[model samples]
Target: MTRRAAIEGKPVGSDAYVALEARYGHFTAMQVRDRRTRGLDLHLERLESANLELFGVALDRAAVLGSIRAVLGDDVRDASVRVYVVESGGRPLVMATAAPPFHLSGRPQSVKPVVYQRYLPHIKQAAGFPQAHLIRQVARDGFDEALLTTEDGVISEGAITNLGGFAGGRLIWPDAPMLRGITMGLLQRMDVPQERRPLKVAALPELDQVFLCNSRGVVPVSRVGDVELRQDGELMARVIGFYDAIAGDPLD
Candidate 1:
């Protein structure tokens, strides 16, 4: 990911483009290139409250599909979107959604955020609808939180938090098939793991605690499936204290 000073330029593109967000000040723009799927390119921009004069552009459905037709001859019909909100302080924030997967035939399943990130342009298909679906599902499910596991069952990160486990009295995170969240990476760097692997769902019962994390920060799990997590006393206190220490200090 790269960050640069926002530049002043007029929107320049073909007829098959529509505006996504038009605000009044400073904003961050995401222009996706080298797209493998041939449709409208997914374009995103976020205007911070202080920078309200900026214009954030995203294509409307008609314009998006039209762009697809121009490139792939009108056969494409769907796309996905994933969102990440990282603090300037090196913390990573993630948000997943229920955007239905594409090139599937049956009643489509709600798309996960990771799937959206995998196919960046897909977000243009429904704009921000899937993100809304994901946020709503998180509130409804009362899930300790959800994490991304590879198709092979390696645990990575949660839609809103990173994944961690306490096994044999040691703090650990998966080594494969996951996102390697910023916090997870930090812990790993500190030599925190006792064992790391493609953690299996069958192993959940062997841990003392399970936790989730992200830039908005981490929340230790009290329960997982039929298993309940026990407080690790001092360890839990240290974790919370570390998070609280970094709460809003953007320069991390």
Candidate 2:
């Protein structure tokens, strides 16, 4: 059993490669600014829940936080961080990795709808090959990301994000199963008029605007499989503003 947080080199999880190479674990990603991040509790809860579900053991909150703090160390305050909780020999180990930070790009994205869903859709698996593959495949279609949907064209989510739409001056979240992204959770807590319902692909044109949100950031959707959607600049701005208004929790 690996008790302490695995440490390797500066702010990067050199030891993490082995765990990921096995492709058998779950993880959470977050953008850290000045060693702080929004929804730290949500992230931790995700890890704890996945750990219990996958490894049948309670997650060590201290160990997980220790690894993340260790990887960030004193050198990395602003970066992209991923904490991986993997089991080996019936014991779970905590690993943390850091990379360059990225924020929301107001640039609208065009996505292609793909009729696919992830296995164990609830847990955020550490390694996602289908998402990577679909992303590459859709890039050939001149699309930014692959929108995962049901065969019936029921909108589910992005290959790597949560889907949101604005229609009739209200925020609508897909009622389908998804990872319940940290950003989405934070935004849901805000004072936005929103609803969760089963959204369909054909409904895209009827909506005023659509968007994709993840731990990195949220961006307006310009097109959904050739269906051009209007961009409600005011709505998107307000959503982003509400997200940013939430103070980040200090990592220390």
- Scored by lDDT, the top model is 2
Q: Which portions of model 1 miss their true places by more than 4 Å?
A: 1-132, 150-154, 191-195, 245-252
Which candidate number maximizes TM-score? Answer: 2
lDDT of 2 by residue, 77-109 (tens): 887888887666667767777777886667999
Model 2 spans > 4 angstroms off: 1-21
Per-residue error for 47 in candidate 1, Å, reads: 17
C-alpha lDDT of candidate 2 relative to the true structure:
0.83
lDDT of each: 0.37, 0.83
Q: State how far residue 210 of model 2 sits from its true place (Å).
A: 0.6
Report per-prediction Cα RMSD to one decimal: 16.3, 3.6
TM-score of each: 0.45, 0.93
